[model samples]
Structures are given as structure tokens and as C-alpha cells.
Target: MATTEQGNGLAPRGTKEKLTGDRKRSDPEMNGGVPGEKPVDKYGFTGGAQQHCGESAEEIPIEVLRQREAKWLEMLNSWDKWMAKKHKKMKERCQKGVPPSLRGRAWLYLTGGKVRREQNQGKFQELDNQPGDPKWVDIIERDLHRQFPFHEMFAARGGHGQQDLLRVLKAYTLHRPEEGYCQAQAPIAAVLLMHMPAEDAFWVLVQICEKYLPGYYSAGLEAIQLDGEILYALLRRVSPVAHRHLKKHKLEPILYMTEWFMCAFSRTLPWASVLRVWDMFLCEGVKIIFRVGLVLLKSMLGSQEKLKACQGLYETMELLRAIRPQYMEEAFLVEEIIELMVSEKDIEKEHHAQLRHWKETHGDLHCKSPPRVHGAKAIMAAEPPSRQDLRQRPTFIVESPLAPQTDRVRAEASKENGKSKAEQQKTIKPPQETANPYFPPGDPSPFLNHMTVKASKESLSSAEHDTYL
Candidate 1:
């Protein structure tokens, strides 16, 4: 399979021959006769004196072929190692932050998502499966449409958002039944679909819920609760004042913060920040999340000074999503903010140690669970709360125990007549004093449980709240 150009270049290495359009190889010196030299043909491949293929051409030398083969083998060997090194470097670069143009492809590579695969091709082509359970297809279909209602483009591309979402969710429901499709998967899948094809989106979703953000989307949401509890601890350590403010105001982290743990900063932050977080998230593992939560809480401390200027959980989560410090800078900025706001938030250091421990132990157990077959179903029975587990519930250092002691139902009845001042009065109450104090004051209280909060100007109003539910 030697090409003509390579053959020409390899032959007659010592002689200078310029090739003409017809693949003729000629040497000018061969044409000219020197004083003692025998006259030769102009072409480098001369058979007889002064003849260029006049009758029979001379046989090519075996040594020439051997030399050419040696050179080719050498080049192949070098190229193989070069490609290997290149691939390794590219993997490193992807984990840092995929360059803009290569992001889509690199994301596929980094997360092990195959855009076109034989097994999944038919699945992608087929229409979503209709199942008997109001359990599986019904729930998947509902979220498929609901995932990105805010995006007009998604709405327009019925195939892109609604259809793809349904396909992936349904297929996954069939693919991994133990941990059936969950609520957070919709938004996470929506974000991936924005940057990737549907198939890649499906696998990326797999890596996320199953590998990356484990336990959170599981049967009990125990992992999600654990992460939030960890976040609260970090916030308290790094931004004690903000933690105090949020609690003094009777704010529960999950009510506002669940989106952060669920989507990993997707809806809360700017797109760029979300990607940066994802970069570290996938590389550094789940521990990066706690550090990030600490970093975000610290950032908000600076904004807390203005009267009634406090932010809700969603806005706070969004701010974390908005800021995208470079890899080198994120560590310092996180530390600086934590130090600035907390004076004592050692959560990052503790997390760093925990990460070291995690690395030393069996690799992230979160991602290595046995795959199950419960599409859109809980993976396992809920773990019952035991005495040992109950004893470990987080205790506030200066504050009362974690979990509020009273339900807001009694407070709501008392405030029905005094709806206007109920929230302000609630904030002033000694019992509620044990709760967070900067709580917003308004009618139709936003706080629904004992962990009640007042509606902020930016939060959902009564009409909007009704619509949202």
C-alpha cells in the first residue's frame, strides 16, 4: 500500500530528482555528461546508458525497500507514544475546564458518555414507552415537560427538550430500576441536554445521579439530607453570623438550599460558575461540595449588612452559582471569604482531611453501588432512625438543638386575625428567638412548617405560590 509520493521520495535518495506531473522522476545531472562520466538517462530510474525506460526498467534495490520500511516503523513507534502522551494531557485539561470549542466532545470523553452506541441507538430512536404504572412513564413524562419551562428554545424544540427528556428518563427508568428516576435528575438532565446530544445527556445523567451526586436522589434522600446538614455545619463554621441570621430568622436550609444539593448549583448559579463547580466536582469528588457551600456562605456575609437586605436560600444558592473563580483562585477565594466571614469556620479543613481519608479508603463508595432495576422507584427500603443515629443529630454550639421543637400551625391560627404583623411579632417572640431572626415579615407566611419563614419581596407571592404547587 505504498503511495506513489512515498515511493518516489524513497527511491534514488542520493540523486536529486524533480518529479513532473506524470510521476516522472528525472535528474538533470543524469542528463548531462561530465568529462569522465558515462552519459545517462535524464530519469533517475535508468535501465541502460542514456536511456529512460527505452525497453526494460532496472529492478528496484531490495536495500532501498528495507531502509524505507525501517524508517516507517520508527515513525509509527514514535507516533504511538506521542498519541498516548497527548491523550493523557487532554484528560488532564478536560478535568481543569474544557476549552469552549471542545467542551461538548470533551464532556463526553470525561464522563464516559457515548453519543452513538449500538445498544442505545434503537432506544433513542423509539418513542417513549408507555407503561401501566402511573409510577414510571407518567412521572417521567410530567418532568420531561416541566424541566425547563423557563427556556423558550427548549419549548420550541419539542424533540429537543420534551422528547429527549422523556426518552432518556424512560430509558433510564428501564436501565436502572433500583434507583428509579427522581426529581433532581430532570434539571440535571436538562442542563446536560443544553450542551450535548440526547444519548450523551442520558449517560451524563447516569454519571451524575449514580456516580457524582449519590444518595441524594435515592430512596430516602438521606444523602441529600446529609449533604445539606454538612452544608449547614460549614456555613455555621465559616459564616457564623450568616448562619445565625438565617437560623435566627427560622430558615431551614433545604427549603431554600435543596436545589443546591439536588442540582449541584445548576439553577442557582450563572452557567459559567455552574460549569466551574462541575469541573472541580467531578475531579475532586463530593467533598468539593461542602467546601463550595462554605465558600458561598462566606460570600453572602458581605451582603448581609443592609436592613432587610438578607437573601433567601435560592438567591444565596444562585450567588454561589454566579461566581466562577479560576481553579487556582477558587481555593484562595474560598479560604479568604471563609476567614473573612467566619473567623472560625474550619469546615473546609475538616473536609480536606475527610477527603484525604476518603482517598485512602476504598474509592468513593457513593459511586460504586450495585446497579438495580427500579425505574423511577426507590432503590432500597428507608433506613429506620436508630437510637445511635438520633443521638448524632447536629447540635448548635450557641443555639438550641437542630430540628425545631414547635410546628407553625399553632402560630398560624394565632396570626390569622393579625396577619399583617404576625411575622414581625413572630420574629420578636422569645420562642421564635431560638429560631433565625432576620425572617421576613408578611401575610400568607412562606414558612409552612415549624420551620416557618416570611415571604420576601422576591419570593413567590400567594398567586405565584399557588401556581408553583
Candidate 2:
């Protein structure tokens, strides 16, 4: 798959392009020279040849993989049965890693994407058919090429990868106009496109933004800005040394971690580690992201000698921006995260405390902003994406904690009295945590139970808003 032209050089006029089009400055000489030969990275990505880890996943014996995939297929076939009887086993397997062959199907099941898709048939196609908002469309088009240029799927401009990526982003804006389109979504959609088709990818992205990480891509990014506080709080307990260094340097979590969490670390970790982190993230929740960030911090600044290198905010920021090779190694990083003691309960507790602090400092978020939609399908259930359309679709109800439907109802009921309703609307509480089909009890994923937040104007900072990776 080696393109003739590479290294920012122009191709000879007669040298035909092997890729979908002529190579851009970002495109490089693909690792494998022979046509159709496997790229040095089994994932079909280039430019990571220098960063190859100690143990290659490709080295896993084919027989072992086939057996693993078989086991996964069996569990998938009887998913609910497995969840009821042996949920712990499934959760552990996810931590180890979903087989690459079954990653897409696994992700669909893990994120409840399959159920979501089934409930709302042809919804993606319908939204994709309609023209997207002009504001989002122009921005989406500009950011498409910046995602995973080293990966074959998005290597070419206007190629199916880029095309599919565009559809997914545009559809989300249409699906949840309140959230609009956030720049952090580009790399995330690109990663999803690599594994699943556009339709499935779109739904997974929905689950990620809405369910897994609520209010992340929403207007003021209140969810993530708040999580930044939560992460630092947990860091104090998990790694006191690292936390002290960050506090001394005044290196706010938002300064470096914004892009990391906003995109679910798709832009932060090595591709292999990114997939593994996602596998767990899908099963557990945002706590997986918190744990990963904590592990990186502990590794970078756990020791006095490590702190010696980071004297000021700039040095500490640089160290975080470019993580060392040892930390980036997939197996090592996942192992460290697993070994780390931080749990969903810990994250949940910190989130609740931070919520109280934010309200005191920022005032009532809802007071300033218009009536904002808390989550997607809750409203969609009450009203379809396009209720007035002639076509009919099933009522896609989401029993998600992120969507406070009952609160919305009570708010509406109070609307008959204007002044009283305004007082009542000071806060719209998030719903309580329900038993997740993906992670049953004893496993513990701390989402939906508390920490109500108000969304708003200072949405994403310039760095966060402009983050293309």
C-alpha cells in the first residue's frame, strides 16, 4: 500500500496514485511495499512504526483468537442470559479486550447501540438524507481530513471514510440540535468509522456523548469542565505527589485534559490502547476515563525525581502533552489502570462534591440559559426527531438517568404560572442511576445517580473548541 509520493514531496507527473487520490503532505510512504501486503500495523495505520509496543496483538495465535471470538459469539447470541447469569465474566473479558474480529458487534452490544438502532429503524438514513445545518456542515467538512490521516479509512479527502465521518457528525447535530456539533467529535467519529458502518457508528457516538459521557459535547461542555474538577479531586487521593505538583504549577485539568476526555481519549492514547480503554469505557463508564488519566499522571509524576523534571506549569504541561513511551505501551497502560484502586464509587462521590462546589461558584446555570434539553431519547420518546413528518416510527424511549424527563414534565406543568414556574426552573435535576444491562451489580458503574449540572455559554474554551484531533 506504499504510495509513490511521500514526505511532503510532489509525485512525478506520470506516477499513478495508488491510494484513492494523490498523496498529501501528511501522507507518508506506507509501511508495507508489496501491494495488498499487511501494513506493519495490523490495524492498517502508518507512522506508528517507530512507536511499536513490546507485544504485538498480531502475535496472538490464530487458534486462540478463533476460540475467544467463538466464546464472544456465544455470549452475544444469548446476551441477556449471560448478563443475568455471568455478567462478571463478560465484564472481565471486556477489560482484557474484545477480539478485533468482533469489536464492532461487541461495541454495538456494549454501548446498547444495537438496541438503539433496532428501536429507531432508518433514523440515521432519514437524518443523513436531510441537509445539515449550514453552520455545522461547513465546520464538519473542514475537520474531516484532520482525523486519523495515518489510517487508511480517512487517508483520502472525499473518500468513503471522510464521507462516512461527515454523515455521522452531521446526523448527530440533526439528532440532537441542542448539543449542536462540537469539534471534539471529529476524531471520535473517525475512530468509530474504522470499526463499524456509518449507521452503527452514529448510534454508538450517540451513546458515548449522551449515555457514557453526558453533557460532554453539549453547548458549554459543563459536564467535562466539571469532570476536570472530579479528576483532580480523585488525583489528590490516588497520587498526592502528582496532585500537589499540578496545584503548585496551577496546571488546571481543563488546560491539558479537555481534548483527552471530550474525545474519549481517541486523540490521546496509542491506537491499540485507545481501543482497549474504549472496551472498558463502554462496559463501566466515565470512571474508566478518569482512571486512565490518573494512571498517566501517577506514572509521570509519582516520584520525586520525576517531579524534578517538571519545575513549572509549562514543563509539566509539556510532559503531559507528550507522554513517555513506557506509559503509552498498550499492555502496560491497561495493566496499570486495572491495578489502580480508583473505582466508579470513588468517581461518583467526587462528582457529587464537585457539583455542589460548581453551583455555589457559577450560580444557577439554568437561570441564565434557555430551557435546555438534558439528554436525547428522553425528549425523542415524548416527540420523535421529526414528529410532523408523514412517516411513522416507533416510540424510541430511553430509560436513561442522564435525561430527566419527569423534571421536564413537572416544569411544564408549572408553566401555567409564569413567575412561580421561573422559581421552580432554577434547577432541572438529573435522574437516578438505574441497573445497567451492560454492567450488573457488584461490578458498580457510577453514573446517573447524582451530580445535576446546568449547561451554558462559556461552553468550551478556545483550545477545546478548536481541538481537531
Candidate 3:
């Protein structure tokens, strides 16, 4: 319940006030007036892309902005060297905040999304040409305007921004057919679209879904539920009083945290803070999310005001939903979040413990069948076994049928073309066993080689970890 106001370490008090005043003076009307529409006195609620209200108002010297942009461009041009030799410096820059002018490209670089975009050139258009799943299409259309309703880019229903948003979400549905159109993903995809082109946004979304947060938006939401448990465990350590109060009110983490984590704080945090969180999140991992949740809980309920105002679950939920704008200011909030001492090792330890608890209480959590890829043969030799099979065979080895078939076809083709079978066989080796589809490549967990009841086994590899699940 410490109530002392701490200044954002990023700027001095006078500088913070100057920045605020500059934004207020540079109202949206001064900056092209929302494209074919009159600017309102205020742009609805103060969150999402409109967090700065009048971002164009700040009159930083063009030369200064160029200097910042140049620094970013140089880092991006030599990203491999920077990542290998100056990762700590890169993280420090991200923590300070990626300049808004260069944020899109910086984000693409940080996520390695530019590489994905290159590999999947023309793929988004291909997916767009095919009619999307009607069910997912309907949901995506309904939710399109619900995201950043006041931002100029998506203000009009069929505007370029909205259309781009539709393509990105639709392409994702086609890309990961199994986890089609989770409601939470729409805002995430929308945020990415705001920064980059539709195709690049699609690839960024792919990295987030497949690499950052695998299994989170899946049908069962098993990852989200497990993380809820993990969040509660961290709360007990970081803010015991808040934890006790929540327990007394029978408040479950899911009731409040589902949207927060699932959407990667796109809804809960102010736009600037959201961007800052994303910057750190791309460089670091899920630990930033856990630290943020703990900070939010402590700030909301750890004061005398809360003892009177948040007396029940309903009031507490409202407090979280309607957190004051000042508290969410990126400079202060992100500074506080990073200052917290939580580490990846701590999060991993808690994850293993939570997984064990979940298994002991709920038995084996069944995984749904892997979603089928359109117009392609099954990637694996066999479907993942049922719950009974999982219990019987914990190793869950997956052999690639496509590889062996391709090798045989190559051998026959070579023989017909006058080359000997021995030459073909020498060139083409037999397919080897690979990890299960559920366990994607580049997973960093030690237990990935085996599929067992150990809580850690259920989690995705460290490289793919996301706060949503």
C-alpha cells in the first residue's frame, strides 16, 4: 500500500510536463484531421493507438528525429552483429522506447518478422484469393471495428486500415487452420497492421502465434488456464495482501487476467505503454508480462483507497478495468516494470510447479488434434494418439512419412532417367524421426525429447513462451 509517487526514470519532472503540454497543444486536427472527417474535441476513450491524443503535436527538431531514425536504421542494417555483440545495448534502447517514427521497422526487425515476410512473399495474397472459413470470416468482420475504433486508419468500416486488418486476420486463419480466429487475436493482428504492411503484419502475427505464444489461442485454451495458475502463484509472492484479498473474495485470476494476457495487454494498457511492453517483450520473454501483472495488482489493491473502495470482487474488477490514465503512462509504468527483479528462471520454476499441480488435480489435460493444413498432405506419419495412448506412450515419437515417400519417388525417377538406384540412395537418405507437431521446432526445453506428466513437459519450449498461455 505504498502511495508515494515515483518519477519515471526516463525523464525529469519538467521534461515530462513539457511533453504532456506539447501533446495537448498538438491536437489531432493539427495533424491532417483524421482523413476526410472532422476531428473531435477528444478521441473517445484514452487508450489504443490514440493514447498520445495528439502525437504529431510534439515539435521535436526534424534533425533530432532523423538522428534517432539513423541510429535505428544502422542497428537494423547490421542486426546480426548488433544481436550477437550488443544485445544488452539493444535491450536498453528498447526499454527506453523505440522512436514512434521507426517503431514499425524496429518491431519487424526485433521479431525477425522481416525474414518471415521474405520467405512467404505472395502467400498472403494466395490466402486472400481463397474464400476464408465462413465461421471465422463472420467473427473477424464483426470484431474489426471493435479494435481502435477511433484511430484514423480504421475509423471507416471499409477503409484501407480495416481492409488490411481483415487480410491479416484471414491469412492467419488460413495459415494456422486449427486455431482459427480467436477473438483475442483480432486486436493483436490489428496492432501489428498499424505498424507494418499487411503481409509483414501477417508474418509478425505468425511469429507471435507459432513462436511467441503457441497453444494459447487453441480451442481448449489449456495454456491460458495453466498460466492463470502461474500468475496466482507469482501474486502470492509479490503481493500477498492483494492475493489474500482476492482469495477472500473468491476472485479467480481468469476472471480478470484472461483478456489482459490473451491479448498481450493490447486492451488493458495505454497505447504507449503497450508499445513499450511489446518492445521489451520481443527482446525478453514472458517474464515482462508476469512482472507487469504483479505491478498492476500491487498498484490497484495495495493502498488505503483499496481497503475502502475494492471491498468485493465486483469493485476490485472495476478498479482493474478503469485504472487511472496517469498510472499507465509508459515512462513511469515501464520503468517500474523493468525495475522488478523477476527473471526467466523464476518464471520457469513456477511454470513447472503449476504444471505439476494442474496434473495432480485435473489428471492429463487432453490436447486437441492438430489443425489440418489446406491443400497439403498430413505432415506427420501418424496422428497424435488419444489420451489413453498418451498415458501408455509418453515418448510420443513422430516419424515423417513424406520424407521416405519422396526419397523412393526420387530413386524411381533417377532409375528411369538412367541413373542407378545406388546413386539415388546415396544422394537421398532415409527420413529421420522428428518431434511431435504439438512440439514445434526450436523449442528450448530439456524435457522436449519426452512427453510425460511432468508439468514442464506440457509447456512449449522457452523460445516460444507467451504470457497468454
TM-score of each: 0.46, 0.71, 0.67
Per-residue lDDT value at 156 in model 1? 33
Arrange candidates by lDDT, descending.
2, 3, 1
lDDT digits (tens) for residues 99-190 of candidate 1: 33233333443343432232254664453454523476766664454444434224333444566667777767766667666666767776
Question: Model 2, range 395-447, lDDT digits (tens) per residue?
Answer: 22223445455765557556745556566666545533333222346432221
Which sections of candidate 2 miss by over 4 Å?
1-40, 48-58, 366-469
Across 1-469, the per-residue lDDT of candidate 3 in tens digits comes to: 1111111111121111221112222333333124344454222232233545655323357567566655765675566666667777888877866766556666665665656655565787899888899888877776666666656666667777778888888888898886787767777887876665677678778766765566667765677667777888888888788888888888777666766776788767866678789888766766777778888888887666565888887888678766776667776688789888887677768878977887888777665433211100011112222232112111232334434445655676666678677776677664233342222465422322332222222223222211110
Q: Where is model 1 more than 4 Å wrong at Cα? A: 1-96, 114-134, 150-153, 302-308, 311-469
Q: Is candidate 1 or candidate 2 better by lDDT?
A: 2
**What are the Cα lDDT values of the candidates?**
0.44, 0.66, 0.61
Instruction: Give me the candidate number with maximum TM-score.
Output: 2
> Candidate 2, after superposition: displacement of residue 20 in Å?
25
In model 2, what are the clashing residue pairs, if there are any? 220-459
